[model samples]
Target: MGLFSKDIKTMDDLFVHQLRDVYYAERQILASLPKMIDKATSPTLKQGLESHRLETETHVKRLEQVFEMHGAEAKAIKCPAINGILEEADDIVGDVDDKQVLDAAIVAAAQAVEHYEIARYGTLIAWAKELGRADCAAVLEQTLREEKAADDKLSAVALGEINRKAA
Candidate 1:
C-alpha cells in the first residue's frame, strides 16, 4: 500500500507501515554493503563497512522483534526512497575512477544511507512511544544510536583522511 493509502486507518497502522518500510530499507542496505566494501580501497573504510554490515544484520532481527512485539507479521514493503538512494550511489561509485575519490564516494554514499536510517528509526521510536509501546521504542532507540555512531564514524573517516587523500 502507498504511504497515504486507505489501508492505513490509524496511528498503529501508520507505525507498522513505516516499520516495514525501514525494514525493507535495512535489508537493501545489508545486501548493498558488500558491494560498497569491495569497492572501498581503504582498509579502515572496508573494515567499518564490514562491521556495519554485521550490525545491519542485528538491525533486521531487531526489526523483526519489533514486529512480533507489536503482533504484526514481519514483512517488507518496497521502499522507493532507499532504492533511489542506492541507485544513485551505485551510479556515482561506478563513475569515479580514482581510488581515493572512489573511497570518498563510498563514504558519502554510506553516510547518505545512514542518515536516511537515522530519520526512520527516530520516527519509529517516536511512533512506538505514541502507541504506548515503550518496549518497541527502546529497541528502536538502540538502532538509532548505532546509526548515528556509524554516521559519525563515516564523518571522521572522511575528514581524517579520505577527503584529504582524494584531494
Candidate 2:
C-alpha cells in the first residue's frame, strides 16, 4: 500500500515492494534512534543505541546496493507498521518518570524495532533466494544477523540489569 497498490502481480514486484517498505522503516529508525539515545539514562543503553545507529546507517547503504543490483531506484514507501511502533514507543517512554524504568522501556522499544527488522529481512532474504538473487540474499542475511545481535544485546542489557534496576 505504498505509492503502489493492487498492481503487484508478480513475485519480483512483491520483492521490490517489500524492499521499499524496509527502506522506509530503516530511515524511520535512523530518525528515531537519536531521540532514544537522548532519552536513555544508562550509559550502556546510550552507547548501545549509538552503535545501532551506526549499524542502521550501514544497513541503509546495503539496502541501496541491493536496489541498485536489482535495477530499481531506492525508494521508500510509507511503512505504517514501523510508524505505529515508533509512536507507541514515544508514548510509553514519555509516560515514564523514573530514569531506570525509562532505560528499561528504551530497551524494550529497541528490541521491538529489532524484531521487526529481523522479520522483514528474513522474509526478504528468503524471497531473494526464491527469485534467484543470491547476491541480494547474501546482503540481506548480513543485515538480519546484525539485527538479531542487536536484539540479543538489548535482551541481555534488560535482563541483566536494566529491568532490575528499574524495579
Candidate 3:
C-alpha cells in the first residue's frame, strides 16, 4: 500500500513506491539486455547494450541504497511501461530477418527502454529532493544522467549510420 492507500500515508511512502517501480524496471531491462546484445548486428550497438547492462546493475545497487536510507526493504512494484516496451522489442525482434533491419529495430527498441528509464529516474530524483533526501537525489541523478548519455549514444549510432543502412 502507498501513501494514498490505507497502509502508507506519507510523502516518503509515495517516494519509495516510485523507487521500487523503477527498481523493478531496471532489473527487467538488465535481464532483457543480453537478448538484445546477442541479436544486435552492429558491434557498437552490442557493446552499448552490454555497457548499459552493467550500468543497470549499478542503478539497482543505488536503488538498494535508497531503500536502506528510507528504512524499507528493497522491492519492486509492477511497471507496465517497461513490460510493454520489452514485449514490443520481443515482437520486433521476431518480425525482422535482415540483419540491418534487425539492427535498426533493436536500436529503436533500446531507445524506447532508455527513454522510459530517463523519465522515471528524472521524476524520482525530483521527488527525492522534494522529500528532503538530497543524498538519495544525488545518487538517482547519477543514474538519470547515465540513462540520458546512453540514449544519446544510441541516437548517435543510429543517426550516424544505422538508420541509413536500414533504409
Q: Which residue window of length 10 is worst by lDDT in model 2?
A: 1-10
Which pairs clash (backbone N, Cα, C closer than 3 Å) in model 3? 3-8
For each candidate, C-alpha RMSD in Å? 0.4, 1.3, 1.6
- Compared with the true structure, model 2 gives a TM-score of 0.97
Candidates 1 and 3, the one with greater lDDT: 1
Question: Residue-wise lDDT of candidate 3 within 1-167, one digit each (tens)?
Answer: 43257655777777888888899899999899999999998998898889989999999999999899878899998888899999999999989999999999999999999999998888888888998889999989999999999999999999987899999
Instruction: Provide the lowest-lDDT 10-residue window in model 3.
Output: 1-10
lDDT of 1 at 44: 98
User: Clash pairs of candidate 1?
Assistant: none
Please state the error at residue 29 of candidate 1 in Å: 0.4
Q: Per-residue lDDT of 1-167 in model 2, one digit per residue for the tens? A: 74357878889999999999999999999999999999999998899999999999999999999999999889998999999999999999999999999999999899999999999999999999999999999999999999999999898889888999999
- TM-score, candidate number 1: 0.99
Provide the overall lDDT of each model, using Cα atoms, as 2-decimal numbers.
0.98, 0.95, 0.90
Per-residue lDDT, model 3, residue 51, is 90
lDDT of residue 89 for candidate 2: 96
lDDT leader? 1
